[model samples]
Target: MVKIRLKKFGAAKRPCYRIVVQDSRKPRDGTTIEEIGTYQPVTQEGENQFTVNEERAKYWISVGAQPTETVKKLFSKKNLNKK
Candidate 1:
């Protein structure tokens, strides 16, 4: 199955994540099918904490891509799961 999930990145104490599309069998940081956006929780409040390509996200979802729990919450915040 294909899934939308976060791929960990960044330094030891400072972590960021790329929201990517990958096969469910792949490792967490393994090859990704597509990178749809990013999330940097450590970034300051005023900065852009995360971003998502709405078109691609919708396309993936339409094609039956499932988002992980965390990713689902993020999408909900942006109203991306209303479809």
Candidate 2:
């Protein structure tokens, strides 16, 4: 199964994440099928915290890509929870 989830990155105390599409069997930071967006949880309020490619996200979800819990919330914020 394909999943839409966060890929961890950044320094020891600062974490950034990439919202990516990957196979369910793979490791968390393993090879991804596509990167549809990004998330920076530690960013300032005025700065953009996350971004999602609506078109691509819809396409992936349409094809049965399941978003993890956290990713689902992000989708809900953007009103992309169609499935």
Candidate 3:
């Protein structure tokens, strides 16, 4: 099954993540089908926490991609409610 999930990256102490579409059985940072957004923790004040292409996200959902638990929570936090 195709899954929308996070791909981790960045240095040892600093972390960044790319929200991507990939097969559910693959590793978290393995081959991806598409990139949908990004997430960065606030190491400093007032940094952009996350960004997502809403239209693309909706398109992927329509095509039957399922979001991971974390991704689903992110969507809910952004009021992007999905089934």
Candidate 4:
């Protein structure tokens, strides 16, 4: 099974995340098939805080890649325009 989920990265106090597609059984921060976006919760709340390739994301989902709850919410919040 494959899933779309977050991979953590960044400094000790400043956390960032990559939205990735990977095998469901793999480790959370393990290698992924592809990276579809990024999330920076510490940054100002707006389109600049995240960058998602919505087209790629939809393609993965259609093929049965399930996204985590948090990633799902992020997708919904992002308008995917103006960038």
Candidate 1 ranges beyond 4 A from true positions: none
CA lDDT scores, all candidates in order: 0.95, 0.95, 0.88, 0.85
Regions more than 4 Å wrong, model 2 = none
Candidate 1 clash figure, as a count: 0
Model 1 agreement with the true structure over 5-58: per-residue lDDT tens digits? 999999998999999999999999999999999999998769998899999999
The lDDT of model 2 is 0.95
Ranking by lDDT: 2, 1, 3, 4
* Model 2 poorest 10 in a row by lDDT: 41-50
> Which whole-number lDDT from 0 to 100 does residue 24 have in model 1?
99
Task: Output candidate 3 Cα RMSD.
Answer: 1.3
Per-model clash counts, in order, read 0, 0, 0, 0
Which scores better on TM-score, 1 or 3? 1
- Residue-level lDDT for 65 in candidate 4: 86
Cα lDDT tens digits for candidate 4, 1-83? 99889999999888999999999999999889999999888876554778889899888887888888888788778642222
Local error of candidate 1 at residue 36 (angstroms): 0.3
Instruction: Score residue 48 of candidate 3 by CA lDDT.
Output: 82
Runs of candidate 3 exceeding 4 Å displacement? none
Clashing pairs in 3: none
| TM per prediction | 0.96, 0.96, 0.90, 0.86
Model 3: ten consecutive residues of lowest lDDT: 74-83
